[model samples]
Target: MSRKLPIVLGILFCLITNHSISQVIKEVEGLYYNTTGDLYTGTYTEFYESGNKRIEMNLVEGKRNGKITLYFENEKIQEVRSYSDGLMDGTWITWNDNSVKIAEATYKRNKKHGKWYIWDDNGVKRYEMEYSEGEKVGTWYIWDENGNLLKERKF
Candidate 1:
């Protein structure tokens, strides 16, 4: 047998075994439970129709507690978010289908609490704002499509 054949076979075996180990869970009262009626705590994955992973999130005691990643149908990363006790608690970022960053923000306990930015589809920054505990609290800037500052407003 060729040396490459062993590597290929090993990868195929891993994929098959990995797929078989995934368990389906149910949500009840906003918490996830496994088939055994126990709190589900593991990597939860959702797949696109094409068998690609659309979302992957980590759960601890049925609560989201880590980084969650979402992918476009083409398998590119579309968004990434951080959570703590099922609440948004860190940096969140999103990208357009073309792989350009479109938006980014920081959150604390599900409330906007830091800098936020938004970009147009063509990758030009369109907005820059700040928040404190979900309330706007600083000067906000808006930019035109050509990347020129259009307006600045103070809160």
Candidate 2:
């Protein structure tokens, strides 16, 4: 092989791999883009001033396509949600700073569309609801801190 062949191959490799690896991503109109003005297709992450990860998300073709996670300043996960084509399309969950889950819900095309739940800071479930295309449907239940059902409402 020619000596210059190796040098040319190395430069080509760096250019081809640069976008595939994690690099800073930019969001415009809710879509992600790379510095080269191409649709971003990689993991995007943001960090807190204290050096802890603040958010991490996977993107494909400039749209959020997989799990997106947000964290508290102390590194505890604050929320976890799924997206497809930049819209909420799967299970979404959130927790308090104390690491206790506060809400859980499902979405389809950015609309609430399945069983939903909410809990109090004490880690007790307080509400259980159902949704169909963002409209309340079925029986919704409310509970007290002791887990006793307080009421049920039908739509």
Candidate 3:
């Protein structure tokens, strides 16, 4: 009986340890990526120190392949962008700290492409420009903060 007692205790300890290990695995199974590690496919939510949502991003097969949203510390949306295979490939919108729309731009394969518009903090149009392969290649417009047309230039 004395020898059987040790063996029984050992078996019980093993069972407890194995159960804890499985619990740890379950806790980490949803993590798609860790900052110190390579890419992973998963969704992650990050928070600001003030307990507000700072960013929400999604990953697929270790690459950023979906929408990303960023927020100011006050919880206002700062920017929203979409990515494909880790490259910016769609519309991106940015807002000022006060929640005013500051810019709207388009991207293609990580390069600025198509039309882009900029606005002042007061919500007035500042400029509109077109780009090809990251270079300003078409007509560009400039306007005053009060919506007054200032100039038009062709690049």
Top of the candidates by TM-score: 1
Deviation in Å, model 3, residue 153 alpha carbon: 0.7
lDDT of each: 0.90, 0.90, 0.80
Deviation in angstroms for 142 in model 3? 0.5
TM of each candidate vs. truth? 0.84, 0.82, 0.74
- Global local distance difference test of model 1: 0.90
What value of lDDT does candidate 3 attain over all alpha carbons? 0.80
lDDT of 2 by residue, 1-155 (tens): 69999999998886565544335577899888988899999888877656577898999999998899999999999999999988999999999999999999999999999999999998899999999999999999999999999999999
lDDT (10s digit) by residue, model 3, range 1-155: 99899999998996685554333221234334444465456775666655577877777866667799999998899999998987899999999998899999999999999999999998898999999989988889999977888999999
Model 3, residue 22: C-alpha shift (Å): 21
Q: Please list the residue runs of candidate 3 whose C-alpha ends up more than 4 Å from where it truly belongs after superposition.
A: 1-32, 35-38
lDDT of 1 by residue, 1-155 (tens): 69999999999996785565454776787687788899889998877756788989998899888899999999999999999998999999999999999999999999999999999999999999999999999999999999999999999
Error of 2 at 131 (Å): 0.7
